[model samples]
Target: MRACGLVLCVLLLGGCSTTTDPSYYWQSVSGHLRMVGAARPVDDWVADGRTSEALRAKLRQAQQLRRFAVTELGLPDNNSYTRYADLQRRAAVWNVVAAPDDELKLKQWCFLALGCVGYRGYFDEAQARAFAEQVRHAEPDVEVGVYPVPAYSTLGWTNWMGGDPLLNTFLGYPEGELARLLFHELAHQVVYVRDDTVFNESFATAVERLGGARWQATASEAARAEYARFDERRQQFRALARATRERLQTAYALATRAERLAAKQRAMADFRQRYDALKAQWNGFPGYDPWASQANNALFAAQAAYDELVPGFEALFEREGRDFTRFYDAVRALARLPKDERRAALGSR
Candidate 1:
């Protein structure tokens, strides 16, 4: 799963007066302009003699996935992903997530257009780390984790400025994984609600999983096999993380603070032991090693936003007869409801 940050206010550069922090808004504006400035039409890249053959092939395949997203998945057919950019870096942005040491609820940052979201994203890694330090300083009991984000969505807000371009950060992903990332980002443009990160991300996650499966059904055997290996590890890791979160939540609810803290440490230790067993079963695959090492209340809370409500959205799709258009309509109806009501409707499904 790709962890996506939202740039909801990128187009509102002129509205800086609405933000409490001018420097933050300026960085968002400058960083987005720099990325959009680097992009070129995919056709140009394919025709360029200087382009590597491997890259040309990947760009062409991306265009095919983009078309499939529109014609088959009922996604927005817009300027997004029609071009490409190479950020010359590992990640497009770094996201900072924070939560109280004893709680799973993440600290929320309210933006002018995006309302309140659980994480803050920065284009520069140092800036992100500095902000994390500030968060820790402000609340001594808070746990902060900063992680790289491969891509983000502007939510169709910047279509006039060439929209969101495909970036080098994730262009080399496996075929099935590529399809899932693209589907997930495009789903944001389909239906999004203010201040509901779990609702929005889980809805997108459901789309990615559903669309990725459809894509793999017609993909080459090698691609299918590769995706199977990758997804299997991902599923196992998510299950472990989910169980750890549940156990910690139970621990946090104990009668006394000392008991809760002791229980939390025990749960985390067990989680690491279980993960070690999984790595052995996987023949020493270490893809999730970094995440496991950095496991904390903030990281667990952030991960939950992408997983918690996925089942309900998947169930909604099934109830809508698995029709793409009908499923989207049903989701949009739910999006219009108040947040509490929307959660109830999905929970019932």
Candidate 2:
């Protein structure tokens, strides 16, 4: 889930001012500030001879997509995604997510006003790993994961400072993937519930999938073909992951603890075997092997956050006649409902 920049001030300052927890506050504040400090205007990069031609082209395409997002898709025309930032790292932030070893349910981290979320993000990777280790130590039966986040949205909270910027971490994505990333992040700014991970992430994922298809339709033929190949593989991978999650869920529900553990091992082994078979279809793609090898409850829960409820949102979009404004309005209306009512309204579990 995307972290709102406004929440940072509250999380950081409120901790120091109101609560006794100052260390966590200081680290969060420092990390976020450092990231925001690194942004530079896209034009500045373009004018510099230091910029590579490929990067220049991608930036130009990003500008086009930004306009399409606002004008064509009715997304907010804000300072977000208008500028660029070079994180000079492989990832923009590292997120710590945890779940019980015996269940797929995620552990919640509650903030003062933001309610609770399933994960916490740190700009520093080491800090994220440390936090994950702490969680593991605290709960012996907890499964923890430290994963990298390429980009995140502040929900337009930093528009005054030029909103969320295009980052090097994600700018190098394939054309369709890059457009989807921007659209997905920007969708977070459109409608965000305080503590509903399923609602927020699934909505953004729907937008990315929906908007990406439209973008692809108008893209150059070469770009379309390239994305087709990438997306097909991605869908297959997601299907495999989802199937494994269901198997794990079933395994965890076993009557006996010993049986559950045995089933869990079998499911994991099958997951790896299936992934290896799928990898062959991709002509030796190793991009997802690391994830398959280290699959755990925390990782599965994280994936479900983005994947679950997506079908429901997509159905809602179709019901809205594929109109962006109508779809967003409908989603916002649902967002106002009580959590249970909201999910019920969407006809999703």
Candidate 3:
């Protein structure tokens, strides 16, 4: 839901801010999600200003880092922060959805009521937990970060986090990676047609990862530490995201609508089973339990995002001589053509 809102925002908001209503963000999300599946009823928008002047300025700094990426790194860069708002934005354009999609309306309300403001595009806690548990069982011992909005972010009270850090607009990314992610998401905002959240996120997350790595190389030890911390969390995050996607695939395999729904329910249950098992498995590992308890469906869904779409990006990164600027340009070029043509270009590259 929040992802949808972000898509509209990023698409609507270029480099400047004309409107900054948080509810507008949420409304966009609901409408987009509903379009793909079932449009649920949402009364009022309740998103507060997660992005203030300070945050906007910070985001712009992140954006400036992107310009450096293109000019300095010679990699093709895409924008996420300045482009696509976050998970919701990507979803709006990509067309993915919740199973009981009707539940999405309730979920969206819960997001705003609870404090969700769409961090890096996705906001839904119930989903992340289910996904995280799967990762815990699968990996048994990796750091995972589940950032929900204040209305969404769970780790908001942590002293280490910055003030009013409710929504993680950059998917819990630190400075440099944040910049890259902004570019990647923006790229999606600029050219994404529809029903290609995977392509959009893959491209953005790829930029986030590869561009982040390149950007990190230029950072100080502290910045590196932040990146290390985020990376560590993302590792387990990826595991859960992978499991969630697999579950979704299993759900999608069902033929009839009833069967599909049943499959969705079963897949969610299985996701819980897998997630719990993983959490228990990782209980003994170092630095791995603080967030396990909060690994709800929303959290899992958030992480699952990365798991499903990163491969395409990895493929692209390797092909572009790891040059992100060129890679960004290449992806934009692909956007000009169709996915098939893009794939062909990638193959040739």
Candidate 4:
């Protein structure tokens, strides 16, 4: 899930006369309102005779996972994931990420409550594309990428809006994936820093991976095997991206500008070639093909944020004796520190 601006900030931006246009703010409000208006409690769906058994099962599983998150993982027990929203769309929102054309550093957007975030989200895909195009035009040297997001979190601020609902966009995901998504999103409510996108996302991802592994421990053999296959592909994808990112960093650091450009081209080509090979090995699984095709600084930076520091967070979990409550308290303590001290504490800077 991508981070979003607060509704109040958006409305304030809409009111302000800034150099940047306010259309983005208005669209965000309209889009979010639509989602909030579409939600109904899971109980309502469960009691409906029109609900399909398969969907009902998935909704029930989501509810169970939500409970597990609160009880076992110490995630916030809120209205999120307790309600259902049929968005009637493939993606809840589309996010636009951008970086300098020559570097992997993600551009940040600053807002009131969220401070600075690495990506901007839009409820409309077309609006997202339009914004991305605007960014490209504004900075011709930037590398812009538009990607769809299945879900996002409001940081429990919108619990009054019935919290975050189980949207149709991601309700059909495999069991393990659904559980991981729930765990990851709920982790945001547990501990979040204002502006540290990398730290925030990586922490959530660590929780997701840890919780997913725990959930798989008691899963049926069939489910475990299925998740194993899915995780294998995910790991392969991450390895490829990481290798390319490392190469790009080295190239940028040591090579002349022209040499760096050439190296980047070769690195991307190699990345796609390796992905093709991996896809063939997966019996033609094409889950990651789109990512490879659109490999850019923006995409690379965005993906890295989720995995960076994850190992450190996992180590912290181990240090906390794998106690969920204790681990969360440790994280919160780290969050209370200044940014530099926090990074030093995690040994990540």
Q: What is the TM-score of each candidate against the true structure?
A: 0.97, 0.94, 0.49, 0.95
Every candidate's lDDT: 0.89, 0.82, 0.44, 0.83
Name the best candidate (by TM-score): 1
Task: Kindly list the per-residue Cα lDDT of model 3 for residues 28-144, writing each as its tens digit.
Answer: 455334332321111111122544555455545654675765666553333112232333421123211221221111112112222222223333444444544544565432323
Identify the runs in model 4 with alpha carbons over 4 angstroms from their true place: 1-19
Task: Give lDDT: candidate 2, residue 188.
Answer: 88
Best of the two (1, 3) by TM-score = 1
lDDT of 2 by residue, 1-349 (tens): 2212123444432433233566667777776677778888899888889999999998998998888888878899988877888878988777788898878998877666555678877778888888788888989999998777888777777788788889998888888888888889889889989878888988999998999988987899999998898888889999998999999999999999899889988988998888889899888998786677668999998889898899999999999999999999999999999999988887776
Candidate 1, 1-349: lDDT as tens digits:
3687775544453343333777788778788888999999999999999999999999999999999999889999999999999999988999999998888999998765677789988888999999899899999999999988888998897899898999999999988888999999999999989889999999999999999988887899999999999999999889999999999999999999899889999999999999999999999998788778888999999999999899999999999998999999999999999988999988832
Worst ten in a row by lDDT for model 1 = 10-19
Error of 3 at 99 (Å): 3.9
lDDT digits (tens) for residues 168-196 of candidate 4: 98888888888888898888888879879
By summed lDDT, the worst window of 10 consecutive residues in model 3 runs over 38-47
Q: Model 4 RMSD to the real structure?
A: 2.3
